[model samples]
Target: MLTFYHAPNSRSTSIRQLILELGVADKVKTVEVTIPRQDGSGARDPKNPHPEGKVPYLTDGEDYVRERAAIILYLTDRFPEAGLGRPVGDAQRGRYLSWLIWYQGVLEPVTILNWAKLDHPAVKASLRDYDTALQRLDEVLGRQPYLLGDDFSAVDLLCAGPFAWFGDQMPATPAIRDWVARCMDRPAVRETAER
Candidate 1:
């Protein structure tokens, strides 16, 4: 059985939602652990196997996976029956991987910097600004319902998660807003939230 270390209301919620979507909740063991929050309310849990003491870490036998994008990839690929991940031969595989990486590499950092009001020139030059990130999302969501064309996949879960949690901070663009709504409307997402 896979062991999932999660923290409620943190980024791990996305993983929990994915697990529910995959219908593998019974197969995996969820170990809720507290993590240091931005507001300094929680403490780092020694039980969390993540080296950084973060939530959303997964362990399977001797193997372990950390980081949201990596874990998403691992679970989706491991449980391909859910069709949340694009397999290697699928045409959208490259696009799928790109969106996953972009969420963690670019979108997240930009959102954090903008929220903290630390959008320095160097940071903007390196990671670009929040507007730029929003523009990218708007452009793609405007064309299709999901990041990878018509299919609702893990990429949508990853990309739309932040907006679902922080909708007030998200832009008023209809495309992005609607896409987020569609992503958040899923029963799995609702179940995760209720937990």
Candidate 2:
């Protein structure tokens, strides 16, 4: 059994959506606990399972799973019946992994820099949009349908979740917004968000 330490109205919601989409709703049990980040709550302490003291940590009746991308990959791999990923060694799988990794790599840094209101002119000057990494991401998203291309996978959830979660931070993210809208309309997403 899997025990997901969850907090409503937080990033953990995406994991719920994942579990539900994978048709493993009954296999996993959620430990509901509100995480008041502004006030520092008990459930959100990183010491629990999540590395960053954030919601969405999972204990798979054995080992602890932290970070959204880790959790997604863990669940998807743990239950391959979900078909959330492409066939192994497929060229498309590389794209999937790349985008999934980018969620934590490029997305996190770009979002944090924007949220922090900071800039690095030295490197940014050489590239477009002041050479910011987010601008480079925007260029990629402008071309791809789902980050990995035409089909959707666990990586799409990984990328789309953060892209949607960080709304208004990059208000010009039309493609991201449209993708999020499509994801939100999915029955699994609606069910978890409502929960």
Candidate 3:
């Protein structure tokens, strides 16, 4: 049995969608770990899984996974039927992995930095480059329905979220909007979003 330490309104909903996507929704025992409660109501203890006290953590009956990208990739690997990882050595596989990592390396911080209203010269200086990142994403999305091209994969879920889930999320993101809608339409996504 796998225990997924998750919370509502937090990043864990994405993980929940993944469980549904994998078709192993029942195999995954979801533990709703609400945050900021301080009543010990969630996966708040870093020592339990993420060491950083994150919302989404998974224990595959043995090991604990904290990061969203890591969890997505791992689930796809463990359950090949999920089709989220795609085939090995495939060019799209590389692209899939790239987008998955992009969330952490680019999307996460970039979205937060822009949303938080940081005005420090140093902070403000490089922040402008987020447009370039957004541009790159837009260019890629313009070419395909999914980030990896025609196929929907785990990486897609990792990119669209709390930060970029609005009208102004991207200045002109029609393609990105379409892709997000495609992903959200997945039965798994709908189920998880409702949670």
Candidate 4:
């Protein structure tokens, strides 16, 4: 059985939702643990196996996966029957990977900087600003219902998770906001929140 170390109200909430979406809740064992929050509210849990003591850490036998994108990839691939992931040969595979990486590499950092109200030219030149990132998402979501064309996949869940938690801070455009609403309206997401 896979062991999932999760913290309530953390990024792990998305993973829990994904597990429910995949109908694999019974296959994995979830361990609720506390993690250090940005506001300095909680302490690092000794039970969490993540080197940095982060939530959403997964241990399956000798293999372990950390980071939201990596764990999303791992779980989706592990349960491909759920059709939440684009397999290697699928045409959308490249796009799928790109969005996941972008969420972690670009969007997340931009959000942090935006929340901090730090405006640096270098950051704008490199990762760009929050508005720019939102523009990219807006463009894509405008064309289709999800990040990857019409299908609602893990990428959508991964991208929309932040907005569900921080809509007030993110200030998404109409298209992005609508897309997030569609994603969050899913029963799995609602169930995850209720948990």
Q: Model 1, 1-195: lDDT tens per residue?
A: 899999999999999999999999998999999999989899999899899999899999999999999999999999999999998899999999999999999999988888878858888888888999989999898989999989899999999988999988756488998999999999998888787
**Candidate 4 segments whose C-alpha is farther than 4 A from its true place:** none
Which residue pairs come into collision in candidate 4?
none
The sequence of per-residue lDDT tens digits that candidate 2 reaches over residues 60-159 is 6668988887888788877877778665666676766666676766666666565667777642453223125445555766887665667567877766
* Candidate with the larger TM-score of 3 and 4: 4
- Residue-wise C-alpha lDDT for candidate 4, range 1-195, written one tens digit per residue: 999999989999989999999999999999999999989999998888899988889999999999999999999989999999998899989999999999999998999899999999999999999999988998898889998888799999999988889877778888988899899889998887788
lDDT of prediction 3: 0.74
Instruction: State the lDDT of candidate 3 residue by residue for 1-195, as single tens digits.
Output: 888888776778888888888899878888775465545555455444556667788997677787888888888887887688866766577777778887876677666776665545675354444666678778988998877778888888778664335546555578877777777778886777676
TM-score of 3: 0.83
Best by lDDT: 1
lDDT, candidates in the order shown:
0.92, 0.70, 0.74, 0.91
Ranking of all candidate structures by their TM-score, best first: 4, 1, 3, 2
**What TM-score, over all chains together, does every model reach?**
0.96, 0.80, 0.83, 0.96
Model 3 off-target regions past 4 Å? 37-49, 119-128, 163-170
What candidate 1 gets wrong by more than 4 Å, as runs, is: none
For every candidate in turn, the CA RMSD to the true structure comes to 1.1, 3.5, 3.4, 1.0
Cα displacement (angstroms), candidate 3, residue 72, comes to 0.8
Better of 1 and 2 by TM-score: 1
